[model samples]
Target: MNGYRKLPTAVNYQFAEDLYSVFKTFGLDLDRLSYSSQTGQMKKLIEELETPDNLQKISQLSLDADFADMKTKHEAFETIFADQAGANADLRQMTSATAIRKILEKNLKTYFNLLTVMKEVAGWELLYSDTNELVKAAKNSEIKRKDENPS
Candidate 1:
């Protein structure tokens, strides 16, 4: 897989850092994971699996501002919509089912987008783990075959 082979620790670090920065920019701490620490850990882990040469190349790519902006917007929307039950207290007092439904529909979209982003992140993590396992298995099999053939 080209994506797996080209995976660079530096790029991963920049991605994590940019994601953190975007969240901070929107005044959301997220409170799930520490970005810098996670980046450092990912760097070390990738270094163990990938070649030094490819690692250097990946580190050179700059952090993508557009991606960061999209993430920031998404987080901002999430923060606002997450407090919907509280936010719509006034609307609820008005007792209009139509208005409440509209608000809920909007909030639901934001919530769905948040879930999509989370799912993408999870998919990437799974892909990385699977790739690492496949690589290890290939290496082990090659070694075993060599032992059998005495080559």
Candidate 2:
């Protein structure tokens, strides 16, 4: 076995490339977006995750938060799709609502892999629900308030 194998980019950088293909009809331009450069953020962050403290900071991260966070690769693609970066047309033009829904479904494992990684990094704690899906961090005050005063 090779002493040092290349780290997986498929789950990180390739995701961006795949999104470019999926939405290329919407005038998506990976190069114009500086796509190659953008992947470094994930590479760097994943490297930082080697540290316990750094990993802890992201442990409570939900999948939505990962995609929505401005600094993440996921957000870059999100912006393109939402036309936040001056995209040519809304998604409904080339694809239907159903196609949009199914687009990411095939990659749920890749998405789940990210979540599972956070789970292990956080020592398999509260980042996930019993169903192994990422969730919001539990808030004692919020839970108590709700119990004390029902909505």
Candidate 3:
């Protein structure tokens, strides 16, 4: 958890908000098109998550199916994103973010569940604690932002 510990979830809130707006506008998940670096960022996250070392740890718990499901969802998102990125406007209109969001949300839940279960596994305490802290920080930031700019 050396370099992994340093991996930051930090992204400019304004930028993420803008990206979310665009995603809403086009009914796509984030800026899956060539218009943004977010797609690459997501891929990097998955790559980092499946690193040899991480995979080894995950294997110890026999949670490969859960991990595979998460990866499949991400891959599906990527596929839809790539298709939408190249399609004409009319073709793009046929796509909806519902499926994308569903898969991503499910993937997230799977990962969260994994982390929760992993906490009970030996050698996973620090990673689980750190990951939990990151989630709490993100939630707090969202609450603060919402409070400051009530919708």
Candidate 4:
């Protein structure tokens, strides 16, 4: 999949600094937020800017303002991180490889049955032949393994 590429660490650092400058220019207190690193600071800043009153404050700012630039950078950063997080969560939720292979095997069997019935249909002959070749190869491999083992 052509998914989002995470921003580099240096870019994240720059985003935090730019956000700090914009907030400072607007007299927003740096002490009001609690965070350890640049990424954390950016996250906290995003959270702070999401509040109802703060949202109103930012909404009134001109598009050419530093705050506007800060918002754009923050959104880009959030989207990349969110994509990475979602991919990781999906990975964690996946079943074991053996289980996945079993499911795929079952699906392929059902698909081959359909292809067998459709072989008389136009354009399906090549597909059915190709699929049969795959099944033949797999069965031949298994037979070779059994002969070699002789147990």
Candidate 5:
């Protein structure tokens, strides 16, 4: 995509620094990641399982079916929505059917919004360049700029 522009050596370094700043704003502290060779294997296991496109499939399945296969997923969703309810004092007190539905709706929307952000960040790739600094800069830039405007 045009988002991945080929930058020169100097520009790439500057961009890397700026990218670090952007990641900080979004709560991604890339500097905290381990660069040791052994850390790579461990990091792979901790990564998210789905791409943005596949998330819709996960959302389509819900608490509507309390099947044995769906039991774990249903319980996880229940826990998340309950946490959402606990996040707000007004929601914590509500037991009315209408209020509960609204809270669940809000929870779903918030969950989907989070998925979208994760998807946006995960879809890009980092192309290699002759200069190590340039390639390093490119990778750093990616952590912040899944798009020019993350907001």
Candidate 6:
């Protein structure tokens, strides 16, 4: 009820604040949520804040947008790990087996932890497998191709 009165305007402001808070907590620069950019979804959100019904719809849109933003960040983190693994190819050749194992184990654990956090926040598994068999197959594939294969 509190957020439903002013309708879209209130919802927009709440969403903007929520996004800003998320960015701040994550140490991301607030400018990344720029309102002026054509690609910025927040601009569309503000525009959608004209009426109560519109605000209710916009609130759902904002949640979808937040989920998308989180997914993007998760992908970027994956890309960084992939890039690092690619760059360290020479290390694989030079380092001892124990050293390489330690490095990989640490990185894999970190990546898994990140994925867990993402899953918890999004309230769903990030992996697309709808069935257990598909999930097992995907996991097997990942294990088989453990080395970083840069895209």
Q: Least accurate stretch of 10 residues (summed lDDT) in model 4?
A: 1-10
**Predicted candidate 5: what Cα RMSD to the true structure?**
34.7
- Give the better candidate number (2 or 3) by TM-score: 3
What lDDT would each prediction earn against the true structure? Answer: 0.52, 0.47, 0.66, 0.66, 0.44, 0.54
RMSD of 6: 24.2
Q: Each model's number of backbone clashes? A: 0, 0, 0, 0, 0, 0
Please give each candidate's TM-score. 0.21, 0.22, 0.38, 0.36, 0.19, 0.28
lDDT of 4 by residue, 1-151 (tens): 0011123344234444444454555445544643234446666666776666555544443223665687788678668877887898998898989999999999988999999999999999999999999999999999999999997
The worst-scoring run of ten residues by lDDT in candidate 3 lies at 1-10
Number of clashing residue pairs, candidate 1: 0
lDDT of 3 by residue, 16-84 (tens): 343334334444453454534666755665575577865655565455787799679878877887777
Clashing pairs in 5: none
Model 4: which residue pairs collide? none
Model 2 alpha-carbon drift over 4 Å, by segment: 1-94, 130-151
The candidate scoring highest on TM-score is 3
Model 1 residue 53 lDDT?
A: 42
Better of 1 and 2 by TM-score: 2
Residue pairs in clash, model 2: none
Candidate 1 ranges beyond 4 A from true positions: 1-59, 82-87, 94-151
In model 4, state the lDDT of residue 41: 68
Candidates sorted on TM-score, descending: 3, 4, 6, 2, 1, 5
For 3-107, candidate 5 gives per-residue lDDT tens digits of 222343443444344433333443354336543322333233222213342223233332123233334553565576557656776855769898889999899
Looking at model 3, residue 126 earns an lDDT score of 91
